[model samples]
Target: MTKLYCLPHAGGTPAGYRTWIKALAPEIEVVPLQHPRPSDDEPLSLQEAAESVVEQCETDEDFAFFGHSLGAVIAFEAVRALSGPPRRLFVCGSAVPPVEASRGRDLRSLPDREFLQEVARLGGLPPEIHADAELRQEFLPGLRADYTLAETYEYHEGPPIPCPVSAFRGLSDGHVDKDGLRRWGEFTTADVTAREVPGDHFPLRTSATFLHRAIRKDLAA
Candidate 1:
């Protein structure tokens, strides 16, 4: 049986995928990488985080990769750095080709109010969190730190990946444009399929059944 290595989005934790894991085929082992927050006692650079996942991946069995947003880019690079290739790659709600301009910047440098507003606009956080000043105050720092890590990542042109790649996008995702998603095809020598689900950027949270079915069908193929 192949292992499924799951990666979380910016400011997201392994717990976010618990429901989705239950819906997946039981034969597949699910491992969600828990990346540490920059201020959470132990901080890891993106490269360090990726290397850790590579080291922890089940080496004896076939493995597949799935990621969303910032995790998507991390998963992609991690596979490339692996000793060998994964069975397949699935990415959701992220721009392909990676964003070069945002690399190396500290997102915490932005005004807290402006940053939270942007987060709300991106549809990642619940409106009720922002509505509660106390909750917002508690969560915004971690969110900003995650953004800083994501925004600071740099992408270097390298050989196109050889494995099959599948991309998932949301029809209502304001954060990713269609052309940006379509460009994912350029990274793979094998088949690359782009699919659109009916939700915002957080389709896994809003439409888990639809997303799971799509993933099951793709992995089966």
Candidate 2:
């Protein structure tokens, strides 16, 4: 059976991909990866998170990576650092490498009020989490850390990997468009395909079954 490593979005845990284990079983084994929270003095960075994933991975196995949003960028960086590249890469609901902030403002630097506004526009985040002050306080730090990692990333130029890239986007996601999706082609020497899945920014949640079916098709191909 093939191994499929699933990475979650920022402020997300490995549990987010728990359903995938059973869904893609028999033919594929799903391994969900999560980032460790750093100490207060040690801020998070893209490289740190990626390196952590690389350490946790079983590099000897035949594996592929599936990541959403911030997880996509982390997966990409990890792939670049890996001694053996994955058989395939699935990047969902994210822009091409060297991801920029939604607007000119740095999301990590924005005030809580303004930063959340930008986040709300992106969707995926539950509204109730923001409505409750205690929850907001608990969640914002990790969310900001994720934003910092993504927003501060600088893509170093390198040869495209040999594996195929299957870029999945949400039909209603305003952040990424067809052009952004197509741009993923530049990072792969092998075939790169763009697919429009259901829902807005969080298709993995809104259309789990459909997304898994699509992934199964790609894996089969």
Predicted structure with the largest lDDT when compared to the true one: 2
lDDT of each: 0.77, 0.82
TM-score (C-alpha) between model 1 and the true structure: 0.88
Q: Model 1 — which ten-residue stretch has the worst lDDT?
A: 97-106
Model 2 regions more than 4 Å off: 37-40, 99-104
**lDDT tens string, model 2, 93-161?**
888875443434476678997887778776846667768979878878878877777776677778887
Q: 167 in model 2: Cα distance from truth in Å?
A: 0.6
Q: Poorest 10 consecutive residues of model 2 by lDDT?
A: 98-107
**Candidate 1: pairs in clash:** 104-152
- Score residue 89 of candidate 2 by CA lDDT: 92
Predictions: Cα RMSD each: 2.4, 2.0
TM-score of 2: 0.91
- Per-residue error at 201 for model 2, in Å? 0.5
